[model samples]
Target: MKKIVLATSLLLLTVCSAQAQIASAYAGRLQSVLDSVGKRFHIKGLSAAVYRPGEGMWTGAYGESYSGVPITTDMYFPIGSNTKTYTSCIMLKLQEAGTLSLDDTIGKWLQNIPNVSGQITIRQMLNHTSGLFSYTNDPGFFTALNSDYTKVWQPEDMLQFIGAPDFAPGTSWEYSNTNYLLAGLIIKKIFNEPYDVTVRRMILDPQGFTNTIIYPAEKRGTIPHGWTVMTTNGPLEDMMVSANYDNTAFLSMATSAGAIVATAEDVAKFWVALMNGKIINSNSLAEMKQFVSINANNGYGLGLFRMRPVNGHVVYGHGGTCFGYLNENMVDSTNGITIAVLTNQDSIDNNQIFNWVVTALHKNTLQMAPLSIAGNEKADDIKIYPNPASNYVDVNLGTANNAKFELIDMTGRNIINTTVDGNYVRVSLSDITPGLYLARLSNTEKGILKTTKLQVVH
Candidate 1:
């Protein structure tokens, strides 16, 4: 028994060593991506993280908070609409625990709003299918918001500005802040506690996400300076340093809809863990992924966005934009690679920065060594050798397992496909063209086991 434990410990150490090696290899590339993007946009501050399952994570920051105050990994930024994901997860967890049902109508919790109908389901609200009017769309709300920048608005107060519903409940789809605002209220109604408290107790504490906070209600002292233009079509300025500038009005109104303040690393960690079924159960995750098509390339899931493809990899995450913060986070569906990009300047295009970061990270993934794990198994158990091969490459799956091995080109075309029944399988590269290809090994039952880049040489 002791020998078995020792062997497992050694294997774990090797896995960690490999992960560290890959992380170190990609560190400079990630930093370069962040710096280049920040410089191009003249961003005041930016931070990012890329998490690769079975490999490791790389976090970096570029530019300054105001002037000489450099942005660090620990600095917090309000992750705008990305907060909706947390709110949705909390609701799902409650449903899983038999406390509530997604089909429960909003009328059960909230009422007496302007045009919101009690018939809107919690699931509809989560997926933005409720067609509820967004309070932020009303210019009058902004006037009142700017009237007292420090004033804390309650969830009920913000509902007064909600206009008529765009469409009836579950008829169509539209993004509405009011949907999540009400969702938060329902959470509060169910627990009789502040929604943020429930968020912390249910999600943050269990995940060890100490760097993240539900904004306004929970405060962090080391938040970096957030920048945005005072008026539309105006020059950008530091909102934090400006006199009489307080984020209370904006964040308080954002509430569970968009007020989570967190570091980029924490954001990435949350996405990776959530997708890996650490935050929610498999059934809940499946429900979250039931996307309603938003467009040809994008869709809306429960508080999640099926974003446009980033370098041929379809990712799932949400983007957030607040007064002076813009953030985009994604976890690759194919590889489970998670990337998060956050900028203190709100005016810049988050997708552009996110795309650039993804491109760089994608390149880094291809360059890293081949190492991956089967379901809940140590990655050291599997090994691929003679990577740059002329005729063939050996795939040792560690133990007798039913799996399929395939070599796919950079264009996503499969070149070689075969099944493995034993501990080892030799993939034929003799007929394949000499170029870079992705080697994938997937279990018949458990899905994709491991994927790594292979260089097929003549």
Candidate 2:
């Protein structure tokens, strides 16, 4: 019996090694996907990573961080609201240790902040149900933030910008940085140390996430120069180019709400580890996954959001933005594959680019071309007949079962969403307006079967 068990263990290790080796072979193509998407979007710098459970991880970077310097896989980017995941995890861990209860009202640990009541529960804060006003939305806060780029803001100082509560606590849901700001203060108060120190002790150090750190408070190494639009209709300006544009004040103000700097690879690994019971226990994870329905296709859990990119495929993750950076991390529920995409420029939609990267990574066959402008290249598994169709279009789902079809416009709006079976399916375009649309086929088993550009004509 012992010999059989040993042999089985050896066999499993061999299979995992082979799978990782196969995944590594796609490195060049993955790199191409980043390069193509980054250039198309005019991103100053971009970094992306993919983590498969049995297969090893892959990371890629593109474009220049500065005029002459290039973005590398090792460079850090502020993972804006993604920091909320860490903050939420800390609160859950504290509950597990009997340090605090989620049901406890904020009034117990904190008191007397204008517009914020003590009646808000810890769970409400973690899940953005507190109805607290988002301090960042206050025009005064922006004025102060712009007034002094070098000034490090205390959590309370930020709270002063809060005008009034959006609604009564637990009455409705609204995304507010103020909720997390108070949560960070509570963590600091409970641990008798800085909030980031608790984060380091609880999550970062245990996972060997050496590259990730709370920014401004911790010295950050040289990172890709991040860019942002300074005015409403302004061009992208490098945040690192001058002290006036420095990210220090913004990051400091972000605090626990959105102030962690780390590589795309580390961000991807963090998600996979959290979901697999490394950061928290199984029960805690289950609690985290208890989602509140936000819409037909999306839901919000504790710190994470359910992303139903297509029919039947759900990924749990978060997206974030800092002064000059936009980042997104998603882990596939079905396959346990994690993907993180980071870009320096804040103007473009990182989700559209992330969806393209996901489709590129899960190609059933290697014969497909690199990811390009939607609708130009066809995948080997699926084929869309006729270049332009006025009333109907036929899709051939080669070797794909239980697939769902989705048509999205250029603005990322869903035009048609439905499920289909068999090898051949016809979609009606009679209602669709004349223009370009991206037709995507996906299922639970395979993340993205195919994404092609389709043109609708009258």
Candidate 3:
């Protein structure tokens, strides 16, 4: 018995070590890109974090937060358009309180809400489907952005350039600050509170996200500015420019659009909470996850962008960009991974690197975990009726004794899991949301499971 106990301890220790090694392996794999960037470019530093559901989590930071100070998991960075996700989340929280509806028109709140000859819903604003023209494209705006760069921008001033509708609202997916800016306004009118307060109360406090700052600079302190490379000879020339890196200040201009600062860890925490229904109720989250076709090329769901190809599992994410820092992050809810990639200098092809980082992380999950049941567990004949199972589905296991069953989301997180026997299993989905999920069947060893993606539509 003593020998057996010792062996059991050793086995548990081995398992723990292996899990840590897997987490470290993922970090090392992603950190390699940051390592390469340091050698290849004048990218002063890069930081990335990856979170796996019910597994290992780590935030890998390379180089400096500034010039010499080392960036840590706690240190903040300017998280550009990633702020849009925050803003979108805030909108959902307001929806939860019964103060507003996605269908509410902008005209209902702001008397001056631009009626660009087509009807646009509040939902479109959050999803970037609103046909409003982007003010950033206006030549005059850059002139403003370059001059007093941190000058407080007014909505009327922004609207002057944002004039006219780009397309009839909801006609397509075109990202515009105008959509989010109005989203802020709608929140303000309904909540009857300052935008910052609404953001803090609705999003930050609820998610235990203390580090997230909106309108971070009040001309309060020396803030990091977005530095861009003007030219690239054999030596790259960094244009020492300042665009308020303080979420407190820049976020004011970005309001509900783009601009917020947070550590990689906090970003991951926000995503994990949101995906798992910690920040918002499951019902609103379900609504937010609903796919709205953006165009032939893509689709948008609430505040998130759902990437759909004529292919594999769709991923949801948002990318961000500012001056000095070019950032991108993705959360595969189905797979339970969150990746945040950042670079301090824009001298490199940041876009390519960000895309590569996410792909590598995703590929790593696929490679590391060979998640398949063996022994020809074909269930072609084992029927699960009502493809989008509403409430109940008659699952015919058909002579498969002691079979293990599970209801899994796209990311492979098991939701409703159990083991049962006999010829048939009556699966009740009253608890599952109306979205795609697989009904998996398996046995203890040399197992087989059927992957039936079910949707519950009430």
What digit string (tens of lDDT, one per residue) describes model 3 on residues 220-305? 22233334444333232223423333233334455566656776667777887777667787677777777667665456677677
How do all models score by TM-score? 0.79, 0.74, 0.72
Go through the candidates in order and give each one's C-alpha lDDT: 0.76, 0.73, 0.61
Residues 203-313, model 2: lDDT tens digits: 999999998989788876766776665556655566677435767788889898988999988998899789757899867887887777788777777888887763234
Q: Kindly provide the TM-score of model 1 when superposed on the true structure, using C-alpha atoms.
A: 0.79
**Order the candidates by lDDT, highest first — what do you get?**
1, 2, 3
Per-residue lDDT tens digits for candidate 1, residues 1-458, read: 00000000000000011123235656666666567656654666777777766556777787777665777777888898999999999999999999999999888878777798988899999999998888888888878887998888887788888898899888898999989999999998889998788999999999999999987898875777777666555556677676457778888888999888998889998997787678898678878988898888888989888765666766788988877677987876656678887876666556655665555656566556554453565455777778788898998887637677877655333466677877687777788889988887765344467777888889
Error of model 2, residue 185, in angstroms: 0.9
Q: Candidate 2 regions off by >4 Å?
A: 1-22, 231-233, 310-312, 356-458
> Which candidate has the highest TM-score of all?
1
Better of 2 and 3 by TM-score: 2
